[model samples]
Target chain A: MGVIIAKSLNEACVVLAENPATTVLAGGTDLMVQANRGMQSMDSVLDLSRILELKEWTLKDSEIVLGAGISYTDLAEPQIATVVPALAQAARTVGSPQIRNAGTLGGNLATASPAGDTIPVLVAMDAVLQLKSSSGNREVAITDFITGVKSNALQAGEIIQSITMPVFQGPQEFLKVGTRNAMVISVVSLALVTDYLGRKLRVGVGSVSPVPFRATEAEEFISQEFDWEKNSSLSEKVINKFSDMVADSTKPIDDHRGTADYRKHAVGILAKRALERVCANGES
Target chain B: MTSEIYTLTVNGNDYQILDGHPSESLLWVLRERLELSGSKNACEEGECGSCTVLLDGEIVCSCLVLAASAVGREIVTIEGLGSGNEISDVQQAFVDAGAVQCGFCTPGLLVAIDQLLNTNPDPDDLTVREAISGNLCRCTGYGRILEAVRIASNSRTVQNEEEKGK
Candidate 1:
């Protein structure tokens, strides 16, 4: 059987409560491909695209709450672009205008693809995942949200309502090395958010592991030993420990995109380049 | 399965259609149900912009768009470009610029370029490149494809002046 279109979130929850055998469709960045290949085994689907309530990006104090169904096209507007340029850059990097128009942050989190463009950026910016069920709502840090590959802390009958994050310090850099530029998935992607400056320098890396991660060790190393202005031996220290630390944190494999070694090398290059940019930013 | 009827406005005309499910993709509805073959189904996964169409004054891949979700939205396909006889300035520019090679990805390209020129009448080369980065044409080197955008934008200017003269 096909799916039923739930006009509202309440109706969708009722559908989930009664018949939990439904797959929820937001942006079909991941779902449509799975459905075409007959991988998604749900007998029914709850189409949340029609639910207007699930599509808003608003500001609550310092937090920018992007609705579960908001498309990159919606976020590409000039006003929305100012929220977070790096996040916007991540959104623009998705695939193309069509992919951006169709994909959702909700689907990205739900699918939990390691190469999910926005995930690393969110991780760097200390974003939160807001999941809502028929019973109530709950929020989890993005770091604690994903448990494993394609497995998350989400319980049954729960759907990601929106993703919330404070508008972090800017001039942030988000870079990914892919096969091509626009459409191809990343070999490795890195997001550097200097929200704290001397307070903290958060670095998020994706496609190098089962889950995108912030290199806490590397962050500590930079904070303690390094100064961007003076003569820096920390570059050598960072390069020395970065490869192993980044590789140790990741669980990459030989996929059609690349091999584990290539991923490791990419991770190292990404790290050095990212910190180099940070240093450059500091210089500026 | 329960079906939902939605009023879809295509180009300028409005048509009511039955959707097997409200969540069904508009690409399938447009290609299979409505028989609008202008947009090809290259990568039904929304990677290739072969299925690109303008949805409610913006560009989107029809493959990833839900059929029932498109209700009450204005859709502009390549077929909607010109009046009755003459092709649109952008479409003509594509032809004049020799942008088409295999012609498979042309319709989506035309739609994409048409939308880009509407927003940025005089765009730089980089802007033109970024705007249509969604629509991929593997045949043409994309040099000529971008040239067509510039050509089309120039055509819009000349046509405006001609009308002003009358």
Candidate 2:
């Protein structure tokens, strides 16, 4: 077993190109846990912690590009929270202070867990991932990046560089239901993002599916029903209908955390509450 | 399975890990190789904060950190929090508040509370609760632990006031 600590992106890419099978270690929040349990083989590892470029985030005009190495603690900072409140909200609900300090956004994406708190928020925001290899770089939409449970579309020799998302000037909310209040994996999570400039409302649902996914049906329904310009209140009937659509979009399973029926029911309630909070013009 | 050699800077001291494996956790290296067992190993996973340590001054689960990956970074374990023969203010507060039960979770909690007080000396009850939410204690139902944090925060405030008066 060998550990190759790369101080730069170019160096890491070269190593990956030479050995595509080398396990990439960012924060090691997930990888190390697996290694401790004998579930992961650390025969060869490309440590990306020394790469400073991956730890910095840039706020471009009307867009935010976050480095994959940006820790959850950094994500909850005032600068990031101001621009992407849902992402920060989700980041706060992550494991713990220790986990938040060590876990990186890129690590969450690379792990590709369906229950990842940040994945649904990224999906709702229409984020895109920049993947790089020694050969070249490519961009993949967040929705397409996560292929399935604990799986991603990252090609061999490629590393996630950064995530880019447009800055929406609207209320965005993320809600997660876990077994306990803290340090528990999400039984079902939801993100609701309103894009006033685009005249669109996007909903992302997680944990209740093989992949965190955007609820296009529910989003479309809410976009058409809600009065965006007036910021009018949504009636109970409309909210219930929208919530049902969000619930209908999930593919939850019966696991230890929760039952499929319960997940479906809970996600709908989350959707209803989120809609009420975001749309009711401060009534909720 | 080959052993590797690496240097880890812990608590202002550099130690050479001669028998370190690439996959070994910082927690393992700290307890076994360096013999700094102050950072407990309750959960090898990140769920429990027993293995919490300061990596580059930020709290992180040592169990979730790769030993080799932590190269060239400053690490502060529970053992490193105080000066010679003198327990830190947080440690003293824990004793005063009777927060140490079974003593298994004390080391990690002390490290966490010390970090919290360093950053926010006057944290509110909610902030204190949030700060120690990661460090779970089955004993005392957390009332004494909360009291310990309050006591530490109050003492720090008093110390600051005294220095100001000087």
Candidate 3:
């Protein structure tokens, strides 16, 4: 296969415009697996690994703009971990040390796997993706960009440049349940970002739906029931009701990793536990 | 298929391959063209760290790295850890702790431990487990492997203090 090493983001876009069908190789964690399995055959590839501009993150206004090329290893940086703990926690659960070292958050979103560990966290944080092409640039929300399972709204000649999300001020938690402890795909993952000052919370769920989604209805219910100023603890009844709402929102299907019933049950348990942890440890 | 010439530095040696493809995995080039078979091809996928190598001092699965993409980068494979006939401290620890059974997974484990100890000489049990979690060993049950890492870490600490005293 022909591969062009683009040293800069502008060079990458120009090459992409010329070879729109060429595969974009970022970290190659997912694409290389397909190539090794004979699942993908490509005539040309655009290697973005050499582009330095795509590897550095920046803080703009009140949001953190992470370059699409930032690896999971970068997510563990103290600055990123403090601002986006859920994303860091999700990155930690990605694969093993080797996988995290090479895998990029941009690659994870581009793959659009429903079971992607970081997708739920991105959705919870309302992350925005910047897609660049020779023509121009456009921004899309994480939910809209990830159209379906193993699919995204990436246009021809376009590549993900970076992802931006508002800085979260409250406590955030990410929880994933897999068959084994490490190096396993998520059966159901949940991310909770609690805004105690705002008297509300944001919930993002993955693997239990066609796309990772926010538990809006569940969030509305809990926010209404929660007394932001006075209540120090959540009642057992409220936790049960919130968990039930989260389970009810999912539209899961049976697959090799888990059954629909198990996914739903697991999501409920994860939601309850995540909410409890946030309530117990959230900042006032 | 048209072939591409890719140049890379592996284990302190410079190499240029005429038949390396940009899409071909680094694991294939290492095992086939360069004859560095120390990095095993257990799972061509990234799930198994059998093809683990140090890419710019960071551990990454060679199976997931494209040979062309690795051009101008530094890579350290299992065969590059020691000079000539002498083995690295981590490898010696594996032998002393009886960490080898079938020995198929030994090379990857040795590379992983070598990288881990370089960064953290005194890692806890959880750190050791996390370091080698990508590597799967069906024969040793990982008990001796943990012990081997602990032994290597202790030995390195002792050697470092001696050097400092001198």
Candidate 4:
């Protein structure tokens, strides 16, 4: 097999343009596992781990721009954690310390695993994914980026450039229920981000859907019912209603990890827990 | 497909491997080609941390790293943790605490504990448990391993203090 160690984003783009079918290797937390399991066989690989540009991140105009190569360990940094605590919280739940050291957010997005721990957080934050090809650059919403389970909207020769998300206001919470506490794939995950100033809340659900999706109806309901100034606490009635709406939005499939019914119940529980946590933190 | 020459900086020494494949994992190259079997290959999948090694001073599962991609990077296996015929403090602590049983997970646990101590010298019980969460020991039930890491941290702190006094 042919391998090219890409040193820069531009060089990697050139390689991808020339070899559109080449597998893009990031941290290899997933790809290498498939290779070892005899599940994946590749003729050529475009190694983007060494690309400095992809590993760097910048925050401008209140929107955080994270390079695709930024590892989970990097996402757990104090700087990133401060800006997007939910994303950092989601990143912290990804695998073990060793896996976090190598596994990257870009790899997670590219893999497009419905159970990807961070995908729900990205969706809740309304992350915009940037894809670059020889032709040009295009931006797609995180919800649109993931077309199906383990399938994405990335075209041939196009690589994930960076992910940009506006810094969320108010409190944000990400909760994942898995088989184990660490190094476990999420059975059902929920991310809740409340915009107190905007009087809106965003809810993103994962694992129970073909692709991670936002509970738009739930969000609308929460935004209208949640009295930020009047209500001292999250009402149980509101929590139950919000959870039901979030659960209703998901189309979970029964797999070996969990059943659809269980996922629906778990999603409601997670959504309620996340919303409760966010409410407990007080405003802003 | 033809094999290519891959050079890795292992334990501060450079070794040139003539039969490295892109499909081959770093764990395979380390154990088979370099004969560094300290890092066990319990699970080729990243689910198990038995093949844990330090890549550029950060612990990562060697099984998840491509041999071809490891070129020019620094890698330290379990064998690199100790000097000639002398075990590391963490290893000694494991012995003292009876953390070793079947010993299949010892090497990876030691590497993970060492890295954890290097970054956090005084980790609490929860920190130690979280640090070694990836490593699985079917025999010890994690009680002795946690004690071993605590002992290692205590000894290391004392040593550092003594050095400061000297």
- Provide the lDDT at B91 for model 3: 88
**On residues A1-284, what C-alpha lDDT tens digit does candidate 3 reach at each position?**
48788999999999999978888999999999998887886458888987888888887677899999999988977889988899999998888999999999899999999999999999988999999999999999999999999999999999999999988667789999997777989999999987765677899999998899999999999989876775567899999999999999999999999999999999999999998888777535
Q: Regarding TM-score, does 1 or 4 come out ahead?
A: 4
Residue-level lDDT of model 4, residues A233-273, one tens digit each, is 76789889999999999999999999999999999999888
lDDT of 3 by residue, B20-63 (tens): 65668999999999999999998888877889999999999999
Candidate 2 vs 3: which has more lDDT: 2
DockQ of 3: 0.71
Instruction: Estimate, for each residue in A1-284, the C-alpha lDDT of model 1 and write its tens digit.
Output: 35567788888887777776677788777877765555664356677877887787898676798888888777666766777776777887888876777787787888888888888989988899888888888999998997778878887788888899887644567889887777878888888776544556677899888899888877676556556344234566665675466556666689999998888878877777766666666556
Give candidate 1 misplaced runs (Cα > 4 Å).
Answer: A1-8, A41-43, A60-62, A76-83, A226-244, B2-7, B18-24, B160-166
| Regions more than 4 Å wrong, model 4 | none
TM-score of chain A of each: 0.88, 0.97, 0.96, 0.96
Candidate with the greatest DockQ versus the true structure: 2
Give each model a TM-score.
0.89, 0.98, 0.98, 0.98
**DockQ of every candidate:** 0.47, 0.75, 0.71, 0.72
**Better DockQ candidate (1, 4):** 4
Candidate 2 chain A: 10-residue stretch with minimal lDDT:
A275-284
Give a tens-digit lDDT track for model 1, residues B126-151: 88887778887889889888888888
For model 1, what TM-score does chain A reach?
Answer: 0.88
DockQ of 1: 0.47
